[model samples]
Target: MVGAFEQALLALMIFVIMLGMGASLTPRDFYLALKRPYGLAIGVVSQYGFMPFIGFLLITFLPLPSAVAVGVLIMSCMPGGTTSNIFTYFSKGNLALSVLMTVTSTVFGVLLIPILLLIYANALDLEIPRENIIATLVLLLVPVAIGMGLRRLNANGGAVTEFMGSLLAVFFIAFILISWVPRNWEFLLTTTPATYVASIALGVCGIAIGYAFARVLRLHPRNARTVALETGIQNGPLAIAIVAFTFSGTEAQSYMAVPALYSLFIVIVATCVTFIFRRANTAAEQKMPDGLL
Candidate 1:
């Protein structure tokens, strides 16, 4: 199990990270999302559709233990986080679409996550605590609601909070490295090769499929890149929070292995993906976004 201090730190990271995600949006964003609905469609098809199938295939083929397999399922089903938005900005992708997709996927996740978990968990004969996960996800929304209200009330304060959330999303990675990794160095070292491969492959495969899916639809290169990162880079902090809060002792640690490892590896994965995306940016595609990213 994660140490108490680490769990507390993880909770704080999630609260503010969610708050920032909330602050990044306004009421108009939702209106536009409904009007356009493009991002929403993409988010649902790519994230809720393909990603879980990928996870199911991975766990089915790989020799992951039951707890570790469930961990992978949870990671695979997560929504795109603010981390994807940051990467979309850096990659010169469609920031507006990225944010919309992140928000859309996350909102839809509240309904989809439990259903998806039940389907996959049942198929695999895994015992997932879906009710606990459901409660945690719903509770997590409180911060988003608060952040949105803050944004509506004070623009400057909202921006500061938004920036804090993105910065802390990155900082959460550092926290895991310094705080979680050291304490669990022995566990990490002893972890099987298959577990490591599953952790790393989830993001990599998700990105590849996302980019390809976007291209198939003839999306602009920037939008395609945005979809790719958003697809691959899931909300790791949320997954960690879910696992940390939902389970305990050896069982919790076993369940945490995939999410924790994925959180650590995804930064590296997204960095490389971002660089590739940056190179793919055409001068025309660079000018495609109407100034949102």
Candidate 2:
């Protein structure tokens, strides 16, 4: 009974997030690809290349259970979140690039996440189930495509799209809270010390490494800030749902819960990074030339 409820909750959560993601898109969003392409490149490369490497290193040194290690790697391998775009916009980052990045990463994730997870799991001596991979793709890709279709139908111009977009955001938040509260209440209280420590460590490491990489590459401060936030934060609710549903039919290890733990950690880390960037922006503005100011 508990298992069934968990799966249902996860499915609902994914649908809500995907719908929100789709409703937020505009036709010009796709067209803008030709105008400014580098933003998408930066977003995608940092998301796929940098985050996964950090996860691999964290898993290697963290002393976590094998399932937990796999869970972290899978979460790192997943796409950027709609929330990351919001954060990027608020921080004066490139909103268009963030949106395109999220869209492209999600589309690629249909295949990339499963393949990467399978390879990583195999390296850890974990069994890979082909059926589970298909299930993950179905749950993620189906709603995304449906939501995009709905948006495209009303793409010409309408308040309906905007209304749906706002409602989708509310629905996603509610679903995540609902899905989270039931399953995680106990785990939050009883989780091991190592789990908490590792979650914090991973969160901190992701932000610092991502920020330094972007800085070294000479990305604009705004883009660097966005990349750091996107790299540190993830589509964690989706990840948690995937694990809960995919492992429900089998005796999956309790270590699958680590993604949930990491999800919470990412929120904390993102919040801190946001504040830091805001302060940095203030400092930069104060130093601006009189003409610019």
Candidate 3:
């Protein structure tokens, strides 16, 4: 069970993360979405469509406890993490499209997450209360809007907001390392290999399906890569927040494990993906002549 101090810290971390997300955005980002709606549309479809399906299959096949399955499903339902933008950059992807997709998906997530979670929970015969889901979603959107407003009101606020966002990211990692991991050491140690496999499969399949879907839609290579990263790198902190808020005591602790593990696993997978893309990009660049460049 999470203590009062830990619960308060978790809430603060989530707010800061969302604020950073909003700080990163501007009216211009939304305008960009309108101008290149197809990329955004395709990204949203791939994120919501493929990831949830992947989570469902994993939960059905794997022997995850009920709480862990719901946790995984919630993580799958979330928007692309800010981390995906970094991975997209490393992978030589469409950075602009990546940002746009992240912003668009997050905005859409305020509504979609609750709805998708309800649907998946019902299908899986899980009993997550609808009210709790709605409450969590509302809590999430409030801070995001405030951050967006801060940026919109003052041009310079974006820089500060971004800095806060980055700082919050570090704090989140540290909190997990120093607090969550140690507190849940027993569960972590006892975690099944299948749980690890399921988490890995979710990330890998999300990237692959997103890329294939983009290719099928005739998107450019860079755009395809961007979609793949966005689809695979989910908003894990948001998942953690939802679990913490909606459940309590041992239930919260059990549910927290999936997103916690996923948060670490996806980063490693994304790094590998980034390395492969970087090497391929470098080779392609070498093959091209200077004159063409």
Which residue runs does candidate 1 get wrong by more than 4 Å?
A: 284-293
Off by over 4 Å in 2: 34-37, 155-190, 249-253, 283-293
Candidate 1 residue 80 C-alpha distance from true site, Å: 0.5
Q: Which is the winner by lDDT between candidate 1 and candidate 2?
A: 1
Q: Report the C-alpha lDDT of model 3 over 75-96, residue by residue, as the tens digit.
A: 8898887888878888988788
- Per-prediction TM-score: 0.96, 0.82, 0.92
lDDT of 2 by residue, 1-293 (tens): 12577667656756766766766666676677545566567666777777777777777777776666766777777788877776676676656556777776776677777777777666666655547756876766666666667777775433355445445543555554566546556755765566667667666776687678778877667767767777766677677666766665323434455666676666657777777787778666545442100
Residue 176 lDDT in candidate 1: 82
State the weakest 10-residue window (summed lDDT) of model 1.
284-293
Give model 2's clash tally: 0
User: Would you give me the overall lDDT of model 3?
Assistant: 0.80
Best by TM-score: 1
- Whole-structure CA lDDT of model 1: 0.90
Task: Give the TM-score (vs. native) of candidate 3.
Answer: 0.92
TM-score order of candidates, top first: 1, 3, 2
